[model samples]
Target: MPTFNVKLPMILSLLLIFLALYVLALRGHFSYVAMRAGNYRFSKIESFNSLALNPLMSFSFALRDYQKDTLDLKPANMERLEELSKIFPLFSTTPKNDFALKNPPHIMVNLMESFGTQMLSLQEGNLNLLGELAQHFEEDFVWTRFLPCQNGTASSFFCLFFQSPIVLSKSKYKEHYLPFIPIEVYKQQGYRVIFLTAGNSTWSDLGFFMKAQGADEIIDEVALLQDYPNSSKIHFHSHYGVGDEFMYQKALELLSSAKEPLLILTLSVSNHPPYPEVPILFSKEQIPLEIFDKIPKNTSAILNTYVYANNEFARFLSKVKQSELKDKLIIAATGDHRVRGVAMDFNTEKALAYGVPFYLYVPKAYQGEIVYDKTRIGSHKDIFPTLYALTLSETRFLHLGGRNLLETQENDKFAFGFNAEVWIDNEGIYPRSSNLGYKYKDNQSLLSTEESFALDEEHLEFHKIYQEFLELQLRYKLLNLAQ
Candidate 1:
């Protein structure tokens, strides 16, 4: 009744105008969100969705255009194509290294959850809750900082095992079935490949993926429950299933009965929250109440649970030391990703979250030949190639695209972050979607926005090659070649 005085055509025109303005506003907001959020999701959506109606998609497109303005390297050239082919060669045809060791040591990879090295130290009361484990690694093993391929647990596992970037787009993931994973490689080389994890493998489709990759045995949390239905020790954490101790116990049982050379991939849990109320290891009550009281409640709870898990690990290691399997095992330890907290800034937290400690331990027999360089920067992609180099018959390239950290220098090294969206090198962090990046020298320090626009052709080439390599790998996978 109030609008009866307005003309019908005039009202329709006003409505259309308002709709257009609303769409424009939404587009602007979406652009801002894409730019702020680092465009990981934007990249995924853009990969397949040509009709991306969301304004955020438009914003992501704009940001990417700005980021890639100067870099126009194409993979279509014949010479570049050939180079990429060599860099990411056919998996089956890739020449195997011959280390010539009569007895290749049994390899064990313990991929720990939320195991960032940001506050980790040897001191008590700080994040160095794993002081004993850190000390053991420093004194006995090859210890260095390694970045994860991505932030999530599944992504980290995919990067480590598949030796490739973990692309989560529906189209990309479905098309690319990587076969260069360590499980397949170990199985091919006559090593019994066993996957042990405290979480649900089905959570990430890795249960089926790992099976397809030729895991001889896949023991996940579901299997644990089925095997130990009456055990009181089996309890689930919110994110990580069951517990670390249970997984370790099961691993030990497998180790004792293992008849062949084993490649046991053990993934630990209990580091995730809601924190478990496990018994304290040391006399924390001895510490001054003032010290404990001053800390934030959330921080205190996280640290307490963390220390408890560390204590459990120490106990597990002690058991390993006393067991006959100690000498036969080549233990490789690393965190899946950095810890996430509300206090942390997501952008700056990249360094903290991705920069996890990597420890490679060879018995005295092989330690002499292996160089334990603590300075080199590496990634999860290097896990298999390093293991291959350590115990193989000869020293040849695995062609997994990761450098053998033992042989590569820190200055020339870099790592890919989650779907190759970001590149971390010695100089700084470069976002693939935007030219804008953060430059930092130290892992703990905050990365400042890089003002200079100088593009390192080497880094650019490396990034292009990596991206093209994945694309070609997917094509090869679809054709069922070199898989």
Candidate 2:
């Protein structure tokens, strides 16, 4: 009994001392920053180096926008720090750099929800929906691997627009106008922005987030019904509003009437769960026989539905070829996330599930000027930047971890998901996370890595910093919105 009392006091005292030291260290770091202009110059590379080594500096990296010289804590930032304390005990605020395009083109981004990369086959013998889309391309398109930040439609907004990791929590409601999002920049360039979603934009606070992205007109499920009272007959309906076919038709309509230099964001709903038995736009005759052979026997409803959506998408593209906007528009297609249906035994199916496919369709006019490689490895975070680079000449994005694909970089490309991450380069796909990890030298020699092992520890450390920066950036934006 006496030993317990004595040890209890000693333990308490030791904890108090440790706490005191931690507080002192924090104060010293802040004070040092205040005393100097910058302890270290803020280059993306230099910041990454410091972030990997110093936790405190990394925390600062989250709070302080390196683009801003002053580090004074604003009221909005204070609120952000308080809220962020739950996740990051010592997080703060900062600004980031912004990039601008000289002359942006008519941009149309088609986000296919619940679509997987495996749905599209690049192999010559394979019959696939992607093959049909590739038929439209005359060596002007780039087929590459892309990773979504998370496996949800809402998180994809941040992935594509903010060029960062998904928010840590799903319930985060507030949306901020971050400089990284292309909306404001596009607006400045006199581009008329339109957002069309075939589903309820409110499904994932997507409507709210899209508005924050500066959409001049957000045509959602409600809007679709109101616009076309006979939408039921004209459009297929499931859990969402109109189907992919109707959405594409609407997109084409908008494109035809759209003023010069327009930006349209289309999020399709046909690929979501409770997959349709029939294709929305395509007849059986229109679908190639090879696509049917690719389907496995006794396939799950989800897989069947996915194939249907893929066919419908191809049909839409076929119609687009006949439209005036074919050469007038630069189309970029990607999935919101991988298909989360029942697993299949096909090669690369698992890898494709986690990392969605990304394709860029360059108009024939600018095809020569635009740069892309079939070996390109990127994440959805790179989407906006890549699109910007293609449309605008020789430009860079600020506060984005992703580089313009046309530019060369020494760092390996990686795609981070909710619980897993994939490293993609010339080495092929290397699953780096402890969970759902795989090691592969080539497509033929793939092996699962031990789940207990942490693959690419140094690289993971860098990713951690990047994620923290995104979280902090998000928190700051939300808090700023609240104020």
How far in Å is the alpha carbon of 229 misplaced in model 1? Answer: 5.6
Lowest lDDT 10-residue stretch of candidate 2: 91-100
> How much lDDT does candidate 1 score?
0.58
Question: Per-residue lDDT for 210-251 in model 1, tens only?
Answer: 666677777876567556643234233333466677787788
Show model 1 residue runs off by greater than 4 Å: 1-81, 85-100, 121-127, 142-144, 167-177, 226-240, 280-297, 345-350, 395-397, 408-422, 429-453, 460-465, 478-483
Clashing pairs in 2: 63-92, 63-93, 63-94, 64-93, 64-94, 65-94, 65-95
**Each model's number of backbone clashes?**
7, 7
Cα deviation in Å at residue 300, candidate 2? Answer: 6.0
Model 2: residues >4 Å from true position, as ranges? 1-104, 120-131, 137-140, 162-175, 226-230, 233-235, 280-300, 344-350, 368-371, 393-396, 407-420, 428-432, 435-438, 441-457, 476-483
What TM-score quantifies how close candidate 1 is to the native fold?
A: 0.68
